[model samples]
Target chain A: MKNNNKKKIKIPKGSNILEGSRAVALTVANIEPDVVSAYPITPQTHIVEDLAKFKADGKASYEYVRAESEFAAASIVVGASATGVRTYSATSSQGLLLMTEVIFNMAGLRLPIVLTIANRGVSSPITIWNDHQDAMTVRDAGWLMFFAENHQEAVAQHLLAYKLAETLNIPAMVNIDGFILTHSYEPVIIPTKAQIKKYLPKYSPTKGSYLNPKEPMTMGSFARPAYYQEIRQSLQDDLSNSIDLIEKEYKKLQKTLGKDIATKDSSALIEYYGKKKAKTVIVAMGSVVGTIKEVVDENKEVAVLKLKVIRPFPYKQIIKNLKNAKKIIVIEKAISLGNVGPMASELKSALQGKTPAKIYSIIAGLGGRDITKKKINKIININSQDTNKAIFIS
Target chain B: MKEIRVHGRGGQGVVTASEIIAISAFKDGFFSQAFPSFGVERTGAPIEAFARIDTNFIRTREQIYNPDIVIILDASLLGSEAVKSGVNNNTKILINTTLNPQEIIKKYPNLKNKQNSLLTIDATGIALKILGKNLANTVILGALAKQTEIITLKGLKQAISEKFSEKNQEIVKKNLKAVSIAYDK
Candidate 1:
């Protein structure tokens, strides 16, 4: 009977075909967060729905909370984490924007929650498509942010998110390009339960931070002007300090799950591909990185720098990788309204005095507009050294 | 890498058909990726889904600008602009219609002079006869497997069973039969 039961529940060892959302949901199940709460939104809907179905089918051992709104969903996880247990939630686009107030609160409260942002464009004319605008909106919310380039990385990053979040006692959000990564079906190898358990153990919060009736401690209390600045400074310092630990934990995960399962880099913060001496280097994040990689392979003179981690910025790493390039092109999906592309602005700021390479900001694929290979090829051929304006590539 | 684009109406399992192709390719020991075109979907509205199969890992996530093969699940979408968008002279087209290839060429003259390979099968009739419904997505895949050597019928059967495994065993049986019947045609 034991052998039969084990055989029935055994997961496939190598890569299995799975929809991206289903893969993420299965990873979340393996992590076995104490509570899972979310409000359904496009692209993100499949993930939470699968989690709920898993709970209903008795495949998962977590509290699945159905919330009325994204605010309520974010709040539910915030409240759940206050009791010192792992919690998770997911949302996209407008749904994420609705959780804005609580999102800031979750970070300030320093709850180690894991949230998945199926990245999408914010509404103007209204769209339910893949973009980075949604996650870019929360770049300053004090949460550790990571973007995945493909389904395999998406699955591995979720495991890494819980580890990073719990260790730093800071919330983490993994950004997956909505509909692009969320809706795509690909061959991905989800790590086994034993592997994930060995990599990311149960969450153990600090004794004094959580709320307990017996040892009653105050959390999220009001701070006067005297201490508020110091509190903000500490959060900033800790986030920037996590740069080293992120790489360390990623290497340990690679060793635990085998290097083939996770990405090859010792530092999962950024992935660099193509020739070391390539004159042209393209920098981007999210699913677009995959497309760039394909293009980079065809064009031998170009390279790609995939930004996996957004917050804490990875300033030194970006400079180290792009220092020798003659031209650095930053193609992105979102902008700061009046300012340049979110990532482009950061690159300009990071590489201002360090490197002599000119940075070009090109925006494409907003509101799910297709960034075809032709468009990327054209962007690559742009010999113009103009770095002043953001070029909207059609 | 081989890219395929599928065109059909909403609720016609267009996405599911692409996913099946991807899964079948995976079962055949190849890397595959499939995704739906980002759109505001509604019942009976035109929609598109894409799949790519390769001996190595598929890295690109962009929409398929030029497809190697095109599958149409509904005959009504045969000559639609969306159907003709990415197709080129080299594209092999499979359609779910009762019309023969000559009849199809008569209706759409542009497909006549091109080097495109056009294959037509009554997938809807097969599906309706076997499954008692107009769900021609899986049925058309059988024709796809017959025409193009991209994926095998055995892989398609396995993919069908795995996809519908969560549902009634009867559904899995009927879908497999529908695909098999369409394959024989």
Candidate 2:
């Protein structure tokens, strides 16, 4: 009756059995960071606590900084990364929104910091379910963004985010469902230190200076109007350039792990499932994409496309992926207030001056709201029964 | 598909109960999915957790508007919004109270049909007599095992043992006793 299963079974060929938060923790720990920081909040708390325990219990050799507020949390991570050491931290809803100012500041300096976001509902009604608003607000922060469809992707993307961020010199935000994925238990195939070390190349920034005191340089000098334009352009360039590096890392991962079944397509920007038959595809981001895939697969006509990489927008790839379709269902977990969902609106602009497939914007999940399987079926049912309505299931 | 809906407040272990059942199913090689539906409601506020086990894929996402089995962790929730939302001739009602099946069928008119079965057991009493707290989850779980052949006593015992430690083995044994008592009494 006693659990004697603690010999650390090296779980060869790592299973995607881990929960989202634990996966994020394992990735950050694997990166062998210099500093880890946070102030605990529900959902987000487990991530920091797990990593902190890993650090404090002599499990990981790193500095674990428990700050006072979310503001301090971001600032701490930013300072550590500025010194050219790998930095990691996590936050949610109010905490993420609080750290937004410093979040942009970290990206503006072109710091390759990796942050894990437990997607939670923002305030006004005060609920603790999943939503995409917290990460959506930071979409324009010049950070390479990614969303996970489930626990496995949530864990896998955290590792990929670090690789992408460090390579592109553009920070990345990896968002996941809060309590739905965070506090839930599932089997995870945890990689051994030796295996992860082989896949993840050590952090080596050629240009950035460390705290040597011999070669000191100003990091945050306010540039004059003439120089500001070019600096902003460089940030844009770095973000745009990350698309290739993201795919490169993904390919390397696929090669190392016998290819990704969740994202089998060569380009790792998005994942697709179902009928591969219908021109009508429902595009979405975040955890509910799993439910959407189930519904579409059952219907036997419609297909589900998951937008894994959100920022840098995967513009050309987006147009290419949805090009074959005559009609598209752009379902956004976070709404854009005045009109269509965020991704749909962005795609609309990208695919401007040409209207091949009529896009129906369905903004269903807001402040969590139990966006179950039936609701998605109803949407698809309505789409089949009548495609005229751009539905909003709020 | 065997659809189960557990009705209880936030702290009554409804979700945990559903998960335990699902774990039992998974160990038996059955595909199962278990999830919970909660609101701004805090502890002691009514919450519903669901489980669906099927030989094939289950695409119907509707809240088991009518579940094959309805577990009442707290008898008070029998009057709650969710209880009446989905109860029918095919539904089997398992409550944590002293009232016998016939007495419950008499008290509730909706359960008048011959097809409906009310299986009542003093789950709270069983828990208090064994483990000490008002943990009707284990007792109701026992009643569930009795009312239906979803799992065997040995299989349920192994599931409980897998979930808990050596110290909690007594808890598992007592729970198994609760199941047998509820079924026989």
TM-score of each: 0.96, 0.86
Please compute and give the TM-score of the first chain of candidate 1 against the native first chain.
Answer: 0.95
Task: Identify the leading candidate in terms of lDDT.
Answer: 1
Report the lDDT tens digits of candidate 2 across residue range A1-394: 1113333332223443333576678767876888898888767877898898888778898899989999998999988888888888899989998999998898888888988888887887886777887888889899988887665566567777877888778898888878666754443445455655667777888764544456778786799999998998999987887788888888876676443322345666887777664777888887777678778767888888888998888877777667777778888877666666777788778777555777777878777666767777766645443433446785
Whole-model lDDT values for every prediction: 0.88, 0.73
| Model 2 interface RMSD over true interface Cα atoms | 9.2
Give me the TM-scores for chain A across all models, comma-separated.
0.95, 0.91
DockQ of each: 0.51, 0.16
True contacts kept of 1: 0.69
Tens digits of per-residue lDDT for model 1, A274-366: 999688999998898888888888899999998999987999999999999999999999988887798999999999998888888999999
State the displacement of the C-alpha of residue A385, model 2, in Å, after optimal TM-score superposition.
16
